[model samples]
Target: MTGFDPAAHLSEKLLERIRARAAAHDRENTFPAQDLADLKDAGYLAILVPTDLGGAGLGLAEASVLQQRLAGAAPATALAINMHLVWTGVAKVLADRGIADLRFVQEGAAAGEVFAFGISEAGNDLVLFGSDTDAAAQPDGAYAFTGTKIFTSLAPVWTWIGLHGLDTTSPDASKLVYAFVPRSEEDDGRVVTRDDWDTLGMRGTQSRTTELHAAIAPADRVVRRIDPGPSPDPIVFGIFSVFEVLLASVYTGIARRALDLAVQTAAQRRSKKTGKAYSQDPDIRWRIAGMALAYDPLPAELASISRDVDGRADHGTRWFSLLSGVKHRAVTMAKRVVDDAILVAGGSSYFSSSELGRLYRDVLAGQFHPSDPESAHATVASAWLGPIEP
Candidate 1:
């Protein structure tokens, strides 16, 4: 029960707690404190850190599966925990593959020290923006940093924040630099959080504005100067594919639960509007059929990406397109399926005490989650169009 066993290693107990907290504080928009604590306690948060650092070292494939599974279990915690997982995965992948020796990031991750990333700026991709002057970096052996890194997904709960800012002195985008600073250190009332994240969706995410006031240290800095430029390597592309695949794969599970709830309620509840058995309607059958159809492709797309990554095959831009497509379709379909449930189930879906409301909002908002559909299309089109667009 303690070690890795795929199907048997499910975090049912932890997932239950997450579902509870998600429903409880979900309306309050607070951090999933208890759930996150459970994640660290159960070793579910730091699955990517090396064993030497007291972690599971299950690799990226396992990591993606775990994230996707948790999303089905609880989307709120899955998302918050995702910020931690991405930092750990990138730091570990970078270190182990001789890309960068972020041994400190590794040990810190195992100790339950959550690391956050600052890639979402005013105008760029949150997922490691491909910007030269638009990225984050450090100056020699110094920790104090200055840059406007916004909308850090886990700002409220993170210990270390991976700040990727533009190295003002450098012109080389290939030499992509990164810095890590303690959020506590930046809490001198210097950093600012704007209230501009009042979006119609994913409101509970608390993804607000983070404004840097001063400088960051050097020892805490992780990825020094590195050529983060163009590489057709699937491994490099796999890093991105993993998140896209996880997002898609996870929503696939949510859709199943939504469909289950809708169909089950149909048999038990009689619609006052029609004065007929809800289960006896043609619309109900068609809805179930549609949900079933929507549920099919997500896992297949996830499997395709996983199979490719596991095999270490060449990941062309076309592959990136496929992975992005999986994410795009999954979230969009999940939103559609949940919206239909709301329409069919009516007032029952909005009952605050019910799972339907929370799940519906989370799943619906998930469609707009940071994985950019436009960019995914662009990344995919790069193959057919040839080279990245200027």
Candidate 2:
């Protein structure tokens, strides 16, 4: 990890290439194949793997910064790639606590294998606690998964997908199985990739629906089977921490881009009646300042929380409250900033082809991710007020 800088790795030239393809990918609703390949070739995928395993050995702090930079250039690419990083980041979290269970994920990522997150399902809001997918245990201890996963990002290229399901057939009927299913065509075509990713924005992510037909996770690969619902398990903590931090980083990046574009637009566009640039208008300047004000605290909070996760700084039960709060704040701030930016950019930005317009749509998605506004509010309320009587 010596002398390793994540920013230097994602060079300006690389970002330019990614940025150039973003519009085309969005317009065509295609996955960013070239973007993923370039990031992999640049060793960006192994940022969280330990140095002993041929990776940068970076931590969540570095990953958060890198995510912000990547999202600024191409939000969809950053987001799609985030699922893979979350696994590796979680591996790092576990390793720091002397738990070597997920080391394989780190190794595989270092080896250029893409890992997508498949925890999301249609109308299932239990998140990490419970799953609608079925995981039937075999004699060999492996689990065969059968269910549909919605918003499976990096669908076209993932080598492994980390998912969870209910294992009713196991000794413990309440066991919630957590495991990785390999992407293969064997076993009479085990996994089905649905071509239904058309969306308002972040179109290049290709986050399609997946139908699993008894896809098996080998015994050795079956990571954890915790009791359904929340517990103090490392798997739960790891996923929540990594997912929230990285997701927040991506949205913060979007806000940064929108704010920058607003400044640029204001500097160029003029007030026809006043015979002056919009940048000179007091009202426009105030709007830009408001955007900046909303955007300021998020990156700092993202950095601090990520470093806390890396350092294993103890927040006890308050961690859930903290993580959810940061995610909610970042998303809300980003959305507000983007809205203000659109006002600054005026009518031209309203066009479909405008970057701000795309960002407007992408920022809306932040509301739909886990730790959503409603969930975040509930988590925070529970943290302070305690849970209501059953």
Candidate 3:
């Protein structure tokens, strides 16, 4: 299917309804259940799954564009669903490279199964390299994960959770086991979802804490068992590449929306002293210009990087640096754009009801996601400077 347009799949009326639900969900601190259902009904959950597998058969570039649009309407809902898309995107990345290890993930997404990412843990900076969660091998070769996972998005509703843990009993002692745990209440009595998602912003995400006490990932579902730390494994590259790009897409969308709101406010509100629209004021124009300057390059850059990933263009060892750099740039730029937008919107924006205000709080969350500012810097430095000498 040539000339595929991802945007055409989602209707403006559908987006309006999702946008209408955003503030209410944020105010009530509730997940956007209806939004997720609507997106699923629209076949959004299967965007990356191949057409042959009963999906849209789109690529990262398309998904990134759609994510930016979704985030503009409702950031929390977009962010929550991003975790599920990450897994499906990773599965697509792997499949493109002749690996079908995650074909079930594709099939599951196409079948409307919700997959949540469960890799995050408290005090674990070694992300994807090492794990604080325990992975004990059972007599049947299956592994049991026992530990706490923080920032577990889609915590309230997930059919499967992809996670990792350290298996000390292995020969290397730091063997990281990567697998998916099914959401079975009977076999997994130890899994606990804490009712504590209250936060400064992005309240609709419902990213609660999860306590996994010996949650089981059957032997057949165990995807990878490799030494901890960096490796040439496709799984590692797939996750990093897809996760960082899609994440950048969400934040870039936030910036785009904030900038748009600022423009609208400037055009409508008049300055009392000058008795003219804020859009005519040199100062307001300058602030909006600054926001545009910061926001303009991001979507294009995101598109380029995403296409490179889809095209399987080889950046060799530079892939990590590129992925992390784009993510870092998007987050920092989005935050700046939102800050300028709030200033342009004036005191009215300070109200909790203001979408810009909520966006300001939501943009703050970009810093905390994986491959954070510090890690991105380190990865970029390592890419250019090589490993630092002892």
Off by over 4 Å in 1: 1-9, 125-140, 171-175, 193-204, 227-239, 271-277, 351-354, 385-390
What residue pairs clash in candidate 3, if any at all?
Answer: none
Error of 3 at 277 (Å): 0.8
Instruction: Assess candidate 3 and give its TM-score to the true structure.
Output: 0.98
lDDT of each: 0.65, 0.92, 0.92
Worst 10 residues of 1 by lDDT: 129-138
Error of 1 at 165 (Å): 1.3
Question: Which residue ranges in model 3 land beyond 4 Å of their true spot?
Answer: 185-187
Q: What is the lDDT of candidate 3?
A: 0.92
TM-score of each: 0.84, 0.98, 0.98
Per-residue lDDT of 173-240 in model 3, one digit per residue for the tens? 66889999888932558688899999988889899898889998888778888889998888999899
